[model samples]
Target: MTTPFRWDLVTPDRLGSMLDGALAPEVGYLTELCRCAGKVLARGGNGDLVFVGRSLDSMFDLLGGALEGTGHRLARLPLSFWRGYDYSRAHVLRAREILADLGITPASLARRARPVTFVDVVSSGSTFRSLFTLLHDWITEERETWPVIRRKLRFVGVTSESKTSPNTFRWQQHADWTLRLPAASVVNVSLDRPTWSYFADRQRKLTKSFGPRRWIDGPAEIDRDDKTRQALAEAVRLVELGRAREVRRMIARAMEGEPALAEAWLRTLRSRLS
Candidate 1:
């Protein structure tokens, strides 16, 4: 079995600096993205909106905060579905069990009068396709109408913009393969290519290195690296304590280590928030 991924620990001061460097400049842009996503949720009707990955969990918190008083319901349905693996009977059973525990069921879905939107950070979009297939089959087994269910389904994908190409058509094509979701229904949020690429590489490495048990387990069953969590927690605590200036200084110092990333983050902030 492959070893689990782990994050290196850093001092609270270092973590604050790192987070400031990574996200402080992007706050306005990230907040705007959250607001826009919230608006999308609002327009999708009153059905439940489910976010599907840990990558989007923190962003979902921001989005939830932005949607305050918007009368939209949001839930996180974390699951990992990589390609090239046969989902065994036991795996399917466990998935069903997890969904049940999360109160996501055919009956509950049918009760919602509005469309359901599933949000995720999309690379090839295989995870969303696999998850949709699983849920569709489950609903079908319950003798639900496919047409009605199809009509009530929506997807929101966050993707990255290639620095060289700058065109999103390739990503759109990749996501459209096999899944027949309408062009309009698959909302995409584009991020800086290099930043996105760095994270994608890390995710691929982690996925490849994870043990079989982790591969089969529901997302909640897998643990996130404690160091990263601790760092983020401390950063949030500092922010809550109203130490904005200290945070800014720390971030500025950290940004000196990667001026390119700092510039890209700043550019994204200006372009999106302006």
Candidate 2:
């Protein structure tokens, strides 16, 4: 199935009537998103940020808006995978094909210039685990260089903000597959609870969810109803904010405390954002 069409922020003028009375988005929603974006860049090791699903679409828009001319790679992978679900052979094959089309196959991962970091709003992290297991198994089946690909793959989970204590539950630490990658490959960024829940649970979206059931369908149909249009407007506004100089600086500032700030690549990216 074909990917859904998201509005192009570069030519908003072309969408004149669609945006004429569009919903006024909550402009103040940027703080949590921008903070998380900075950490996505800082901890992403200056690599491509691939949003794993629809939940983080707004964050992707925010970054894409601000990264307009910086040569930074930002993208979205629409699959909505879940752990502990059995898949039929046809479904698995189609999923693999989709991954290949996104240039996420073993060969591409091995030759990429920078790492590919997957970002998503996470709860139990079942989605991340499911996607990782598929890729790991596919790499082994293809006999690709695991050692080379391991370093180039990374994951960043956007979790609900919580105070840290030894007893605090951390999803990555409890997942067995995490041991397969380098310790630093799996990291996290937190957003306040209200905003986190809003994104993961209640946000309006323009496209149908691409779960396993929808894998073999025809091209996705975009919904142009009032809700979809309003969602589109909010998304468009996010990109505009990203293009602002002060907003870019704010996102860059969020990176100041990340440990990745020490790396030259991350340092260069921070400079570009600033």
Give the runs in model 2 whose Cα sits over 4 Å from its true position: 10-16
Q: The CA-based lDDT of model 1 is what?
A: 0.51
Model 1 lDDT tens row, 111-176: 657667777767877777777777878888898766666667777666776545555454556654
Model 1 spans > 4 angstroms off: 1-47, 163-183, 194-212, 215-226, 234-274
- Per-residue CA lDDT of model 2 for 1-274, tens digit only, reads 3555666665454675776678688867688788888887888877789998799888888888888878888878888885666888887788888888778888899888889999998888899888898899889988999999999999999999999999999999889988999998999989889888888898897666888877867447888778888988888888889989999999999988788777777787779889
* Candidate with best TM-score: 2
Model 2 reaches what TM-score against the true structure? 0.94
> How do the predictions measure up, each by TM-score?
0.61, 0.94
Residue-pair clashes per candidate: 0, 1
**Residue 195 miss distance in model 2 (angstroms):** 0.8
